[model samples]
Target: MKPEVSIVIPSYKNSPLDLENLHKNIANLDYPQVKVKVVNIKVSEGKKRIGYAEAANKGILRNKSDLILLINADTKLDKDLLKILVGYTRKNPEVGIVGPKVYSMSDPLEVSPVDLPVLSFNKFFGKMKKVDPLWLENKRKPFSVAWISGSCMLFRRRVWKKLSGFEKNYFMYWEDADFCMRTRNLGYKVFLVPNAKIWHRSGASIGKDNPERIYYVKRNSLYFLEKYTLPPGVILNGIKTTFLIFVKTLRYFLGEKEVSKAYIRAVFDYLRRKKG
Candidate 1:
């Protein structure tokens, strides 16, 4: 029997053409037991903009299915993608959340950094290595990961309720990592289903180099670090992370003064929230 799946897409100020493309792609999927819900957030006078987490929760509340898939408005799916994800979850009961291999729409083979490593302040402060192309091409089996991008993820409806959906305080970023960490604390595993793939127009909803994006990312990183780190490590990591942020601010200021200012403001805002 085919499992019922609800796809929740959170969209903000998307163009009519983009919505048509997204709907058309979903319509072509081979899966018969699927429902697509778009939680649209429009910006206008006397209306406040809703963030990704809240928008997603709104869509989730509208559907009652066995499995839920969270996807962004800027994504395009493959015909068998939903079938593959649902089939994997049905077989692996221990896996609570599954994310697909997302590729750049402009360059199909270039995978998005959705399959991220466990969060570590040391790594954040140190030099990072690029993901090897050989490993990406060779890894055909589903494997456990620290977390998967919320851009395109599948999980059981029961699990979503258990976690109480994405953390609303996150507003926009780091919510996926927060969700996965909480899911792991409950003894469930998060996996990357390499075979189920999709194409994403990276940062289409928000511009890639937008200062607002930079602010949210930096602020949210601090939030996650504080929430998860142990006491002594928290103090140590906090200092290290702050220093790293300062370094980044200096570097960004050289090229983009507005983005640098946003980064600095993010640190101050995060600190103020912690004290209050």
Candidate 2:
């Protein structure tokens, strides 16, 4: 039996090229009973009140299906991706959330450019890329991961209901990781289906180099680190990140043309905000 699938896509003021890429990707998808819900988010209007987490939550709330997919506006799903994920979730009762191996749209078989920052979480979870000649020859099975990128992920609706969905406290960064950890604490596994694939337009939701993006990444990450992990670790990492921000600010003050003063403001936001 084919399960119902709901795809929740969050879009900002995406470039024409990015939207075109996304539309092209979904144009030929083969899923039979699928519903797509799009939530358009503009940062200027969102204003820390509703960031990615809230936008994504809005999309999720608008959906009604047994399976939920959180997708970015810049992704294209493979024809069989939903079938594989939904099947896995059904066969593996212990699995709650499932994600595909996302590749770069520019380089379909390669990792996306934004894959770096979350490498720490991947390593911590023992999901280092599989590299073996024989293993490469065989079809891979769904395997557990610490967390999956929010760009393209699928979850059981029941699992999401049980976990109470993404934390509204988080504005942007690390919400996926925090949610994954919450799922884990509830004793459900997060799976990465290597065979199920999608092409991701890197950093389409957040302008990769935008000073505002830098700010939210810093501020929301601090919130994540403080909430579930040790404070000392949070403080230590915060100090290092804060120093980097100061150095960038100093460069801007010295009349560096490209380094933005907005970057410094982000650091202040990170340091001073009350916990949400």
Native-to-model Cα distance after best TM-score fit, residue 183 in candidate 2, in Å: 1.4
TM-score of each: 0.87, 0.81
Which parts of model 1 have CA positions greater than 4 angstroms off? 33-46, 114-133, 245-255, 274-276
Looking at model 1, the pairs that clash are: none
lDDT of 2: 0.69
lDDT of 1 at 184: 80
What's the TM for model 2? 0.81
Tell me the lDDT of model 2 at 73: 77
CA lDDT of each prediction against the hidden true structure: 0.77, 0.69
Residue 40's lDDT in candidate 1: 50
Model 1 — TM-score against the truth?
0.87
Instruction: Report backbone clashes per prediction.
Output: 0, 0
For model 1, residues 128-222, the per-residue Cα lDDT tens digits are: 23345457656788877776778889988888899898887878888888888788878999888889999888778778788888889888877
Where does model 2 exceed 4 Å of error? Answer: 15-24, 33-49, 116-139, 256-260, 274-276
Candidate of highest lDDT:
1
Query: What's the C-alpha lDDT at position 149 in model 1?
Result: 77
